[model samples]
Target: MYSTILCRTIECLTRDPSQNRKGDPGVTIYKIELLKLQETIPDLTRFLSDSECQRANRYHFIKDKNRFIICRALLKLLLAEYTALDISQISIEVDAHKKPYLPSHPSVYFNVSHSLDYAIIAIAENPVGVDLEYINKEFNYKEILPNVYHQKEMDEIEISKDKYLTFYKLWTRKEAVVKAIGKGIDNDLYKISVIDGSHTIPSSLVCNQKNLYVFSFMVNHNYIGALALTVPINNLDDILFQPLPR
Candidate 1:
């Protein structure tokens, strides 16, 4: 069922410009196919910090290690483009909650997320969080849904015929919200309500007295994604999906 939904979503995303959503002026998004970038890892390694290199080496699987290196290297490359700073000079620091940030360029905000085959980054002037998830039909949602989802959200999923799609949509939205707030999974997912129509354009979400707007979309059909931002949703339109240079 998810595969079917993915095909339809991809078709919608690839539709003619006249039929699709227009680009947003305030937000910039970049999507990279990790598998395609693997060959470039050797060359991209030069941009990674010593700590990053060590972190990458800690991953037991060679594929996982390579993905980390590529994601970090690509993130630095993208930040350099927007900040006009040298890639080697850009420094990343994490908050107490573990959200990464550019210490040297505080005004430039960004968030990154990666699934099995892709990595996505979102950049904006204000705080932002982006999430990408591969729809897996094999996972057991019944046992996990109750703990992770709000009662209302669980009810929606329970009543839906396509539980898998509904679960990912709700999961991504909640994760995006928490990420945008830099709280990670420590915050309760139930507190955030991102059900279908409720989070329409210009939606208002109050987190720790700070308001945010969220936007959700499909990534190449197979993946579900969402972006949470401190700015207005109207400032964001269709995501500008660009490929990573090899």
Candidate 2:
């Protein structure tokens, strides 16, 4: 399934500001390395709202705290480009499902996900969800598989030579689908399957009498990522992969 999906690697450190003036008709994905933005922490903090700052302060560890700050700050920076609004003036609100949206710009829909080293944002004209997972080989997938993955998915992972990578691929896809629906992990993870070759779309779920599509990809050698969107896969073209400036 991944082999058929188009994935591009972006190396630019900056983007044209004019590109953000309007939302793309298709999906636009922005990738950022947290370490690259560490120097701008102070500036990023200033762009965050009071509520965001409070939430960042709640992190128990300094690293965790900074990760939150960098992710949020970058989100605002990218969003500012798309909305053509001042970074500080970008009003963000969470829905009942805890998915963040631009209240002033309802047509723009987006979702964000981060792994240990990278943060990714997916923007589209419709509802979208994205997930990124850092491949951890030492972690115990054996104990957690049954609870989150369907039996068929578990069978694929168990028989694989590299169970760790397989697990993350399936996990990110399921997460992307739930996040696309704005339900987060509250939905049953086992209900979706990415390994079932029959479902050409990465994963699928029926929501409000409509079907959602998920597509998985390899973000880098170390990270596995997935994107879920309301539009059918065939209708999605022009997925731009750009790197956000620090």
Candidate 3:
């Protein structure tokens, strides 16, 4: 249970030139409410490339298609702001592991995750990964325990006052780390232990000889969010949360 912060939500389109400048040594998390952006779907597509549009069209459902467009559009807008480039100039490419990146601006690192009605984009000066999950209290989590949680994490959750929250806390942590490492979730998640015994502070771990720091927080009572970074967070203020205008 890392210390949680009440996200300081703000409009995603708000421009804070100083807060998110390229090379700024910090992270900013942008939240977008997909359900609120239904009318803007057409406008959002203007920010995406032809390939992105094609990918969105591949989704079987309109909701999923719109969600992908919203996520990518907001991502391009945010990156354009940080890189001081026109949104159309941003060319996003993915690595062999399928983690997205800006080929022209290697220094600007980011990751995006969405669940249900919302999506989050985390941008940092260094490599970063983020995860957002809607807490489904009624979902059966026992079947996933063995495949995803480490033995220690399973034990900790077994005795947790709220097993559902604990499950998500650790689950998001693992997902964030894998994203940060540019590895897909198909890896052995059970081998990753996020229980560092240090509550209230970012958990530090070494993966593939890379030092990673993870922080978990509540994105409101309904969603659990986590961030993984290649560098340690020097100040809590380094992480900013700005929710897009509904």
Candidate 4:
């Protein structure tokens, strides 16, 4: 699996930035016809699970059943060609930290993350964790930063010119690693240090942890992406990369 897959709203990329912020994030709907595409990849058909999916988490303060439909749909569409099965055949489970796994295909483990305009699904045969964060200056970093990082990390902020953004890069990377380990913020982040100085990525990023490869990407002109994967596997270059057909 990759450290993480960073994505953006194909629609959002075209909209006026101010409008996306002022109004509700536009709703996206999935067409049932795409489900029929499963004929091409029969394995994905199992992922539809219409009964429970029809009932999503209504308790959630915000509602987006359509988003879930499309997210799963997109995943099946992507995997269809590889397994040559339908999108609905794909089955997944979530771990204690909410990491998603493929039960039918135990060799494939993945993590899903999204931002206001983007949804990403990462797949790997190895157990992995993934997280994506869109830096919001309006968001409070101080309140949440301490839970994982210590005073030293906080102190680094004062001395850095882009301390706020640095916090996100570090924060996202830490969270990604935590998720990879199947642990959430409940795990201590003191063990992780993301130091990107003079092209120097820390040797300690995961020296203690064996077989995990960490990678990061910058997105939305400002947001940072962090991903961690178990190593000795395929490097990302071998994987096919493409955006979903919005």
TM-score of each: 0.85, 0.83, 0.84, 0.65
Give me the candidate number with maximum TM-score: 1
Residues 130-175, model 2: lDDT tens digits: 9999999889888877788778788889898988888888888778
Off by over 4 Å in 2: 1-25, 196-206, 233-240
Per-residue lDDT tens digits for candidate 3, residues 55-138, read 999999999999999888888888888899998899999888888899989888999999998788988888888888999999
Off by over 4 Å in 3: 1-25, 196-207, 237-239, 243-246
| RMSD in Å for all candidates | 6.4, 5.4, 6.0, 10.3
Candidate 2 global CA lDDT score: 0.73
Model 2 quality (TM-score): 0.83
Compared with the true structure, what per-residue lDDT tens digits does model 4 show for residues 1-246? 112222111221333323323222111111123343434333332356765355444435322554555567566665554456665676666756566666666665666666555555665556555556767778777776667676767787768798777777677767776676776665445646545421222334433344455555655565556666655333242222234442
lDDT of each: 0.73, 0.73, 0.76, 0.53
Off by over 4 Å in 4: 1-47, 55-63, 95-98, 197-209, 232-241
Best by lDDT: 3
When summed lDDT is taken over every stretch of 10 residues in candidate 3, the lowest stretch is 4-13
Report the lDDT tens digits of candidate 1 across residue range 152-204: 77898989898887788778877877787776675355656677643322222
Candidate 1 residue 239 C-alpha distance from true site, Å:
2.0
